[model samples]
Target: MHSVDKWIEIAKECKYLPENDLKRLCDMVCELLLEESNVQPVSTPVTVCGDIHGQFYDLMELFRTGGQMPDTNYIFMGDFVDRGYYSLETFTLLLTLKAKWPDKIVLLRGNHESRQITQIYGFYDECQTKYGNANAWRYCCKVFDLLTVAAIIDECILCVHGGLSPDLKTIDQIRTIERAQEIPHKGAFCDILYSNPEEVDTWAEFPGEDGFWGAPKVVFQFVHINGLKLICRAHQLVHEGFKYMFDEKLVTIWSAPNYCYRCGNIATVIDFKDADNREAKLFKAVPDNERVIPSRTTTPYFL
Candidate 1:
């Protein structure tokens, strides 16, 4: 068995693990994830986060602000990889934490978790550049396949990577999805991961893809029918780090600060003290002087 604690330390430093260690880590986490349902159930006193997008330093800052896992439970609503520099380290750290403390954290699938999406984004290239092969990327994708599609916090707040899907009505519908594969082009599964909340009167087609842009009425209907108090999702960039929509019936949490390294957006996570009482903890990206930026051919080291 690999020492997950050691791997956590290494990943926090923004260093990729050796090929063997990474493979083992993936295998370990995969076994743990395989037991999770498509719609996993989580308790409160948990920190709910949005997209990390491979911002490893910002993720570290998030831990600092919201409290670390096991100590402060977390439910990360996907997009763990891609769009940022440290996809490998960012994801590896989370995987390690999951393996070490499965009950304390929940990781849901984001639209970007798909193999096609990662290839088009940045994760595929990051793996190849870091390991001189696609093995690492493949291993991570396997974990992505097993990642839960959505999570319910304390049986009230519905958490998904994207917004409401037109094809699905209840949380049970989400539970029926076979999530152990690459995300499909259309249908409830795809829509759950790709849809977005909009201000329109009803559900609208999201341009260029299988997702939908949902309106306030759509959200209200879904929440009412499902007996849900709120729908929490993350897919769009909210410069404020978090945004409440449809009269707080739904919330969009964005945890990647200064997205893409220049968007100037603050990151935030929701800390649920209990099922009823929750707080939004906001944080900024780690300063350049505080983090090590690795070169294309070198491991990261403190400046």
Candidate 2:
């Protein structure tokens, strides 16, 4: 096994390691994640973060603002890669951290983690460009397939990348599904990583996509029947750092500051304490003045 410290150093610099080394790292981490259940259970006194979307510098800023690994028990609600310049760095850093401190961190699979989605978005191309081959990307996908779909905290809060699914009624149901595979087009697995709740009383799909429209009442019934106090998710981008709905029973937290580097939105992380207390720590996007953002001519095809 390679040293996790070395990978951490490479990640701190936001630099990609060699292809062979990255493949080794991915294989090692995949072995560990394969042993985890679909619904990973976590205890409280932990911090929950939202979509990262490959904003590496912002992620570094997040660690500085919200506390760092091993010291902070973190449950990252996915979207770790895609749509930013440093997908490889962002994901490998998180993967290295997981390998180093598996007990201190929980990595849930996001919609972008899938091969089909990444191919359409940016991760696959990013990998080909950065590594000169698709091997590293393939290895990472193996790890993605092993990631858990949801996490239950303190037996009261349900944490997932996306909102609740109509097909899901209990946390046990989340665990029963076989998780080590590609995310299906339409199913509990896909829903767990893509569903979002509608803000209005009247339900409507997102304007140009086959989207889901869920309500506060839907959230209430799901939590009530399952004996959950809250549902914390991060699939949708809330302009505000965080949003509370249904009288604070469900919350959507977004951690990617200045989403896509243009959304002009702030980010937040929720610290879930052991005694049922929740506190949100907010932060702004790191200024990108020093970075040269190129024009969209060479941008990924999905954009």
TM-score of each: 0.95, 0.93
Q: How many clashing residue pairs appear in each of the predictions shown?
A: 0, 0
Best by TM-score: 1
Please tell me which predicted candidate would have the highest lDDT against the true structure. 1
Worst 10 residues of 2 by lDDT: 202-211
Worst 10-residue lDDT window for candidate 1 reads 294-303
lDDT of 2 by residue, 1-303 (tens): 357898889878889888888888888888888878787889989999999998898998889778988888999999999998788899999998998898889999988899988887889998888788899899999999998888889888899988766687777889888888998877677777877887766344545333566777778888899999899999878888899988888889999888888889999999988738878999888887844354646563323
lDDT of 2 at 204: 42
lDDT of 1 at 105: 90
Per-residue lDDT tens digits of candidate 1, residues 1-303? 358888988887788899999999999999999899888898877899999998888999999999976799898999988888888899999988898999999999999898998888888988998799999999998998999988898888989999778888788988888888999999999999899888999888978994899999888888898888998999889999999989999999999998887888899999888877988989988888987765566432111
